[model samples]
Target: MSRFMSAALCALFVFSMTTANASAADAPGKAVYDINCSTCHKDGVMNAPKLGDKAAWAPRIKQGIAVLTKNSITGFKGKVGMMMAKGGHPNLTDAQVKSAVEYIVLQSK
Candidate 1:
């Protein structure tokens, strides 16, 4: 192949790889969890579910992701503890909250 053509292909390959890696690492849900969820979930603050805690998450998971997302967005007061709407982050859009919920569920299960 021509030198210029080879260089162009290499550049394209690099660009595509970089984009894919970035997207995979910074998935919407993971990003939201890093910012909004790590605080409570990481430490189980105020009884928040810990990441990868399948036993703790079993009942909630049975309730389904949709309900879990709703509770995360609208706020849930459970016997263990209460979660404020959007984890008390008013700036969070419903989509963001849902993403966080999905991320947590994915990790737990």
Candidate 2:
């Protein structure tokens, strides 16, 4: 192949890989959220923050992701319900819990 063509293909491949990697980070978060968080969060069961509810999430978001992540991982009791640590799945790693929190927070906002 021509040198120019080969370079173009390499660049394209690099760009595609970079994009995929960036999105991959979110995929696990979304997956974890779907399996663990969405059950209550999507429907507001027991007053859990409903997914995509800007008003419900606004104050929590203001407290910042750190506090939210901590609450989610360590468990928190609020007016309506209690969030079990790791959403009651102790098997989940801290990273997974954090990812799920990230997914939920971004979606709610």
Candidate 3:
């Protein structure tokens, strides 16, 4: 391969890795969210509020992150739907639940 081609490939690889790391850092809770919240949130199951749906999430967002985290950890019964404690995974830690909530809020808003 040409020297220029090798350098370009190396740069591309570095950029790809950097981008992936940046995204992961940006959404620190994404892993937790995927495991615990995606099932319901992704599809809006039982009116859980679909992830990234601004309309559905607007009111919830207005409630603020603290409220959202609390509800996720303790569970909530709202007018339209419910959220299970730790997203039905009781084994999850408080930090995990909070992280998931943060991720949801980030995606939502």
Candidate 4:
């Protein structure tokens, strides 16, 4: 193969790898979000707040990440609705819940 052709192939491979890694890194909590949070958050079921509703999340975001993480971990009872502890998945650790919360917050914002 010509040197030019080899260099082009190498650049393409590097670009594809970088794109994949960037996409993966962008969603740090995607796994936890998918497994635990998607059910309610996807459709705003029981007022759970849809994944990208800045209006719905604005107030909660104002409350700050620590509070959001705590609510996600310990469960929350708000005027509109409630969230179960660990998203009703008792097996989920605090870190998992927090990761999911961070993902949700990131998307919402």
What's the count of clashing pairs in each model shown?
A: 0, 0, 0, 0
Give the TM-score of each candidate.
Answer: 0.76, 0.74, 0.74, 0.75
| Candidate 3 lDDT tens digits, 17-97 | 998789668776997788778999999899889999999899989999899888889999998988878889999889878
> Weakest 10 consecutive residues, lDDT, candidate 1?
19-28
What is the TM-score of candidate 3?
Answer: 0.74
Model 4, span 13-86: residue lDDT tens: 99999986886587758878998889999998998889999999999999998999998888999988999998
RMSD of 1: 6.1
Query: In model 1, what is the error at residue 8, expressed in angstroms?
Result: 26
- Winner by TM-score: 1
Q: Write the per-residue lDDT of candidate 2 for residues 1-109, one digit (tens) a residue.
A: 6999999999999999988678666586887788888888888887898989999899989999889889988999987789888878888888988888888887878
On the 0 to 100 scale, the lDDT of residue 15 in model 1 is 100
lDDT of 1 by residue, 36-57 (tens): 8789999899998899999999
> What are the clashing pairs of model 4?
none
Q: Give candidate 1's error at residue 85 in angstroms.
A: 0.3
- TM-score of candidate 1 to 2 decimals: 0.76
Tell me the RMSD of model 2 versus the true structure: 6.8
* Two-way TM-score contest, 2 vs 4, winner: 4
lDDT of 4: 0.88
